[model samples]
Target: MSHRPIALEPAAVDVEVRGGIRPADVRHAKETVAALTRLAHEPVLRATVKLVASPHPGERRTAQAVLDVRGRLIHAQATAESTRKAVHLLNDRLRARLLKTTRDWENLRGRELRDGEPGRRHPAPPEEPLPHRPRREDPVIVRRKTYALERAIPDEAVFDMEQSDYDFHLFTEAATGQDSVVYRAGPRSRGDGYRLAQLDPRPGLLGPVRAALTVSPVPAPVLTEQEAVERLEFTGRPFVFYADAATGRGCVLYHRYDGHYGLITPTPA
Candidate 1:
């Protein structure tokens, strides 16, 4: 059966500038993002650019953009001392990501023809940590997000994470029907900078994963939310993944760039 084509949204892009940004800089941001959208292989459904100038010291001017290309979302953000510099940096990052997404699509199609099976996209380039203020002495959970996790294979999960400009992604593993997370393993890691952690790992249960993945031999530690916070502080890792003691589900306690904590919990299926 043939499927209907998806309708594309209007070409108008949204630009929001806050904190006394000059009109010239604002126009530059809009034009740059509009130019980037023209490079997308898919329909540009929705696009938004936000520029913020903070009065606080060390909180540099920031530019962030989110583009909805058909059903996929591409995100990029950059900060600099000047608005123009931030916008330029943002453009460079967004352009790179857009190119990567296009490459991923072409690669997948080629592999399908050769292997006669679904193909995996290349891993995203390593991400640099976001600049932030000094760590607060008493950091509290400022953002709490609870959502139904996506069910996907490790390869697909990695693709989504990269497209969304996330350092890590949490999802339910389709192969073994277990909660899992795939994250950048850092430059010091052994393999292709990707690691997988599952709630209850089974050695041979997972099917073939195309992307180079290092599965954590140790199962997710069981801990309460408070305990997870302590672990995050003690370990000094970017994020801590653990099995929630009360829910028996995987949760992540992460350090936000704003010197606060963020909690991610999976909603019941």
Candidate 2:
């Protein structure tokens, strides 16, 4: 079967290489990403590629890309010993995601393509493990990000989470106007593997959600930052999501790849 190639405007794709990458390598990364974007079936509104040099010897370079395809965002990341290799791996990961998303969208609309069609399913590549982190006596918060929480339905939040390769996503529930979080409930083998937690959830407030989600009956815990940190240490979970007692907003405190702590708080809307 022959399919028309989609051409993306050169200006729509942005590439940024950091950590002293050479000009030739930067151009190579950009061209590679551009070629990947051109294969999209839908209009590629915008594409961004970021390459960072890792200090660790195990994975010397990391490549990540985010694509805005007809208003939907898709993200992929890869790491390799060399810059060119990293970009090539990123391309493979992004291609698989694009194909899977297209197949899922078509299925949702009851327009599934034939078995050997262009949008045939492709399994995503396994993610690279985090670089080794030196043991630390006490890991303090090394990074903090504050931004306005995205207001979206649970389905939208889940989609954003999966696209961004995030384990959990914090957002304001559009239906109830409450701060909420949706996270992976368990391994992929488990049912849908999605769960929802809302702040002061009320009975019969949620509408029909496309993803199978287990809503927590208990309201989200309200805690100060110090208290949250203490709970994080006690529970040994990857992240702790809670409502800030001072500002009454959703916040996430999680373990960073470098064996440090990172905090994400919602700014005032």
Candidate 3:
């Protein structure tokens, strides 16, 4: 769709071709820059469009766009059979991201405005529950799925996790050959960090996946529990993982909601 005339000059949009992209697709994206800027509800500072081709047949073209609104970078991505379709999908995703960012900004601003008013005080902290209530949804194995796990070290895994834009990532620890996951602890905040966990299968269970998986490969460096804990604190991530020096088994160190560190180890049945 056409948008109101705005500054969508030649330098406003940058289309980077990795493999190759159709000329028509690039033209369409440039033409739609104004519409994207309007959706952002602010003057677009800069825009980057990336096109990459995949080996797969049905879904070959992947499009990614990064919009710089002021100092914030909003990202969108889409994959389709055709480059044109992927670009369109990318535009739609970018619009959605802009809408969400705008809403969140407005909400935060409203909270600040209210909190700054006279005669208003900061809300009290939540009361501690002696025993947590059970969740409404009962435990059920609704589906079973598996992915080939890639091998990586804790640091490398954390880097990959950050780049993937996923809450949690599963990989095989390069040092111990054990399965591990790097995950985020809480809401996005400045200095908010990630946590790492490792799985040591109980006796007779499968261990050390040797298969290549769909994940970034990273180097695994052995870490002591104390080192992991220190890393956790330094990163401000919720948890950390390493081979427990005492147990010789995989272990997880995490931050408990009550402001304490909790450790988990698998015990034999």
Candidate 4:
């Protein structure tokens, strides 16, 4: 493959070559790095490209690019049949991620500015703690993972949740500091979107706790069952808990593990 002339501004970008990358491939990558100069200005748009040796002879190279676009990290990687093709794929993926993140960030900023305008006061509804009675039953503890609860807007959380490709994400509401979980409800074709369920830990339970538990009292977002189902599909999770806006009751939407969804709503006592 012919080596393209390097167009990347050396002072603004740093290139790291690793594994068994050939000199010619490294030269191609330097030219490809120039592509990112259009994404951001000099000095502010810094990027690191790591070229790794590909295991298969057909796919001769793997490229990983981590671009620091004004402090926010954007990562993309590609493995292709050729070094140049791999670099091209990496750049394409990186551009898509950067554009999506930029659009989401701008939309969030715009919403914040609008919410700050005067004469718009939407107070949260008053919430009373739900009754909780301790259950005495030995349960199996299979797995446990400690995670730091980050405070972010729902849009940002959704972005992270989608990127993580997890069933659910637990985060704190940036506006209220309320601990919340965003979970997938069902398939996206069914109009299911991500649903946020704020944790409202109920008191008045008396028992010897069998396991360590941390609960935070907070209010959940009120959405109808249909709305909850729509949000559930976005997270790609099996279940979600949401406050039913119609009945003013808490409900759970879960997958039956047989290609179906089960909606559990509070019954009148």
Writing each residue's lDDT as its tens digit, candidate 2 over 87-192 gives 8888887886776676565443333334454332223565554342434578788889988888887777776676676678989998889888888887533435
Model 4 clashes, total count: 9
lDDT of 4 by residue, 120-185 (tens): 122212211111111213212222233455767655565565443334566665765555666545
List residue ranges in candidate 1 displaced over 4 A: 1-12, 15-25, 52-56, 59-62, 79-82, 103-127, 188-192
Pairs with steric clashes in candidate 1? none
Q: Write the per-residue lDDT of candidate 1 for residues 105-182, one digit (tens) a residue.
A: 656522422333223333323333565434688988988999999988787887677666677999999889889999
Candidate 3 error regions (>4 Å): 1-7, 55-59, 106-269
Q: What is the lDDT of residue 105 in candidate 4?
A: 52
Ranking by TM-score: 1, 2, 4, 3
Candidate 2: misplaced stretches above 4 Å?
1-28, 41-46, 52-61, 68-72, 79-86, 99-123, 128-134, 137-142, 188-192
Candidate 1 to truth, TM: 0.78
In model 4, how large is the Cα lDDT of residue 268? 31
lDDT of 3 by residue, 1-269 (tens): 63342345644689887566678777877766556776655556888887775433443576777777776667766666677877777666566566656555534322322334321222212212111112223322222233456666554554444333334566766776676776654443423455444555321233332211232244223567667657767776555556556555545556532234656554521
RMSD of each: 4.7, 5.1, 18.3, 16.9
How accurate locally is residue 186 in candidate 1, as Cα lDDT from 0 to 100?
68
**CA error at residue 236 for candidate 4, angstroms:** 18
Note the Cα lDDT for every prediction shown: 0.77, 0.74, 0.53, 0.53
